[model samples]
Target: MSRIVYVNGRYLPYAQAGVHVEDRGFQFADGVYEVCEVRGGALVDEGPHLARLGRSLAELAIPEPMSMAALAHVMRETVRRNRVRDGLL
Candidate 1:
């Protein structure tokens, strides 16, 4: 069986997954970041994370890196790739 890792705009094998240097976050650290505890693969403190995301954007006056819908889709794919069933809260 094979797993697909979602990165950037594509699904790739972990070995082939890569992030470009040109990525805005990498280039200028202009994007916000998030790290959550995955418990049994479920996200923990999701509300807080989203709140922080909002605050980060407001503080920097930067648009969100991805639209809400796009972010949800990509995240689902990434979690699927990583096979996380729950996350830390």
Candidate 2:
């Protein structure tokens, strides 16, 4: 299966993933990210990770790209698509 990456609001093939050079996240490093450890199809240390994401975004004065629920859903979907049961995402 081809790898899918979430960029902007769409999931695209890895080979096609692209971000505009002017995007703030790329140009000014104005973004926050969280990595949830996947274990047995579940996320580990999720709460703390989300908390940190929120804090980082707040500190950077950038609103979250999506809601926590949406972010969680996307994270799980990405992991599932990649067939990653034990990994950091």
Candidate 3:
């Protein structure tokens, strides 16, 4: 079965991970990125994640990805959507 992803405000099917043609991640490689580790259905180190995210944005001069509260919600939902609850912490 296919999974759903919460993108922006929409829960979209995984097969259609679309973005605007002008999105900078692919356009000018203008965005810095991070990979967060998940455990016990939650982020392993969210504090560090946010710190790293902030530093990355600052280094690249990119705007904040989203408000801290909003990013937390999406991170939790992403773990739930991926069904990582059965795994380790």
lDDT of 3 by residue, 31-85 (tens): 7667777766778878888788888888878888688778878878767877876
TM-score for each model: 0.65, 0.87, 0.81
What would the per-residue lDDT of candidate 1 be over residues 1-89, giving only the tens digit for each residue?
A: 46667676778887898779888777887766677676665666656777787788889898776776676567666776678777532
Candidate 1, superposed: residue stretches over 4 Å from native:
1-4, 85-89
Write the residue-wise lDDT of candidate 2 on 1-89 in tens digits.
Answer: 89888888888899999989999888987676667899997889877888898889899899888997798888888888888878889
Error of 2 at 27 (Å): 1.6
TM for candidate 3 is 0.81
Off-target runs (Cα >4 Å) in candidate 3 are 86-89
Candidate number achieving the greatest lDDT relative to the actual structure:
2
**Per-residue lDDT for 54 in model 2?**
86
Superposing all C-alpha atoms, what RMSD in Å does each candidate have to the true structure?
A: 3.1, 1.4, 2.6
Whichever of 2 and 3 has more TM-score, that candidate is 2
lDDT of each: 0.70, 0.85, 0.75
lDDT value, candidate 2, whole model: 0.85
